[model samples]
Target: MGMITWNCTEVEEFILLGLTRRPGMQIVLFVIFLISYVISLKGNVLIIFISRISPRLHTPMYFFLSNLSFLDIWYTSSIVPKMLINLLSFKKSISFHGCFTQLFIHLCLGGSECYLLLAMAYDRYVAICSPLHYTTIMHSSLCIKMASGCWIGGLINSLIHTLFALRLSFCGPNVINHFFCEVPSVLELSCTDASLNKTIIFFCAMLVVMGPFFLIIITYGYIINSILKINTSVGRKKAFSTCASHITVVTLFYGTIIFMYMRPGDIHVANQDKMATLFYSVVTPMLNPLIYTLRNKEVKGVLLEITRKRHVP
Candidate 1:
């Protein structure tokens, strides 16, 4: 009992055993992640800016896209800067409070994103399935409510898990074998029996991640059926094109998350987990804005107009 108690001294900080130990690799990774982070911030901010100024993009789709941009900005910012710093610095330590804060914010943004994707899917469904009732159903008030619900649900879900995690006794061996603080990564260091913590993670994930994912699948199922019903081949192609960007983004985001979190902690191969975390946290945010804006004619047209206006001077 004495030895056990001695081993269970409350941890003050944690060392993040980041992606690589090789000095050369660290430098290369730092440069790559830095560029990716800058591009992600710039791209998402531009999306928000264009969404605000462009009257043509004042519809529900762009509105949700703007929310997604805002979320991606906040989400990536929560994880990447710290990761970049850790990659360059010799001391890869984060304080206890900082870890919790990161965990809370990361979960909040991720959970909200899941629901936001569902909302976007529903918007697509309305646009395609019941075109006549689209405006009536997705009015300003309802859109605001749906967006608010996504954020609020995410916050509530994060708060629940964070509060419970705080109750556990984190004893010794405080090196986290991942880039940033995540639920499963942190739980690995707990001196207490972390079965409960793992259970909460699984349950919350099912609700926050899997639940929205299944909804998106169902919504898209309806959407694809509707697209199939279109008589003209051109009409069907156009409809599929409208959805292609979104489908790509969804697949990218959900695929990484499900692969990372849905499995048991024991099976999470260390290097693989680190790379997967990088993909979702760093890579996905950068890709999202590029995917949406590059594929979207309305966004391109607005950007071109902005460029033209600047050149006019």
Candidate 2:
């Protein structure tokens, strides 16, 4: 069923050396991460609900956004709750199967988010650059296809990396120097030579992370150019407003990912990686809903109407 050698010395579990080691800080960290997890779930779920029920948001952009919110839920849910429990309890160990499951889910959702954002950038490009053809180019069928492609692309990417990781053997000193079972952290504990794994990770990082990032940058380039051509100040401001939230989210999301993964495997600083993961995993998901709701006037109006309607009856 698989290419990996399963008989290599059995590693039953892994100890996660969470964000901090100071005994006093564990409680503090627990509270903080617990609150973050709660907010992340609430915010992303509300975004999905509002995006679905608001007829005003029944467009390509909101469709992509709802997908994004859904991914965010899976993304944060994969790691944060376990992390919270670890912080509170003395048992910081996770079963070998559980670790890999977390790895697959996080990577699948994270990679999906990357491609989903790419789709969003293209949506903006079409809406702004070729307004007349927007509806025709990004029809219902096409949107579904693009979104489906993102999820499938992510699944394939995760599957490749997961299999690659499984091929290596993890032996003693089975302590991962982070809050969760990330690829790099787990790979550090491998007893066998992992040069191939490192190389593949670097290539995948470039292809999945940088590849979409550059695409997003190029798309925004055309979008900005199109906005500049508008004669009126109001027109330019409105156009800028449309894509501004996306740019902000992109910067926040990619800034952490690029920093975390685009490095020589040996040079990774554990504490720094933990903090970066924290931002991307917890903070970014929570902020996405806030960013879209607060910054976008249309969503805010819809949210208000929803609130008002509930009170009216």
Candidate 3:
């Protein structure tokens, strides 16, 4: 495909054509997203707080859960506040630096979560499949190293993408189609060829998204096999319960992500893209804390005990 040569000028700012153009709808969206953002923040914060204060919850599993909650808090924060502002604002413009900064942070946190989930899956795998050596294998030093590696890996991945995106020239029509600056949406406006960007995106998606995802699947396969070997029904149920929440969360998160990134570039639809991004970016974070806590007896018990103490006083 030949590059479309537009008048070459530096794009200093970008107009984010947000989720909706209708005035009435923007207000409604603002209200809805504000509530969602607040809930996501509070819920994730509560999980972090509960994990820290309760000694019973201090294990490899809860340790990873707390990391996940922390990541979710920043993941939602990186996008939602700007989205809420855009929903309420008439202009809906973001500076060029700001847009790419959003892109970097979003990708960093997102990539981090992918690896964190993989780490969590590995934790579950060790706990279930190697019950005898679980504590020794997932020791504190090892867990910390794994968590740090996830963050550092994500940072490196985001930095590469952001640097390449910055190099792309946006000479004209500096309008982003989506509510927030994302790889696909921003690439659409590039005056220069974005084939390389797309290629990098595909390559990185394999490394940061699909790679961990497939490993998780393999890890869970072993976990299921181990669960099946347990003699008693009650033992099997207990084993399955430990995994249920993580499976649900993985499905919900990775489903949207695969749809968004893994599909062919030619199959672009603005509305579908927006909705998919909204589900993963905004809605999933809000649901994660609920998924973890509601399904977890230990977390629930701790919450109940904390509530009872306040009520007694």
In TM-score terms, which candidate is top? 2
Q: What is the lDDT of residue 148 in candidate 2?
A: 99
The residue ranges of model 1 lying beyond 4 angstroms of the native Cα positions read: 1-9
lDDT value, residue 225 of candidate 2: 96
* Total clashing pairs for each candidate: 0, 0, 0
Residue-wise lDDT of candidate 2 within 1-313, one digit each (tens)?
A: 6556643747899999998888789998888878887887888888889888888889999999999999999899999889988988787999999999999999999899999999999999999999999999999999999999999989998998899888888777889999999988988888888888889989998988999999999999999999999999999999999999999999999999999999888888888999999899889998999899889999889888988998996
Ranking by TM-score, best first? 2, 3, 1
Pick by lDDT: which candidate is best? 3
All candidates: TM-score: 0.96, 0.97, 0.96
Q: What is candidate 1's lDDT per residue for 152-270, written digit by digit as tens?
A: 99999899878877877887899999899988888888877878778888888899889999999999999999999999999999998889999999999999999988897578888
lDDT value, residue 146 of candidate 3 = 98
**Which is superior by TM-score, 1 or 2?**
2
| lDDT over C-alpha atoms for residue 123 of model 1 | 93
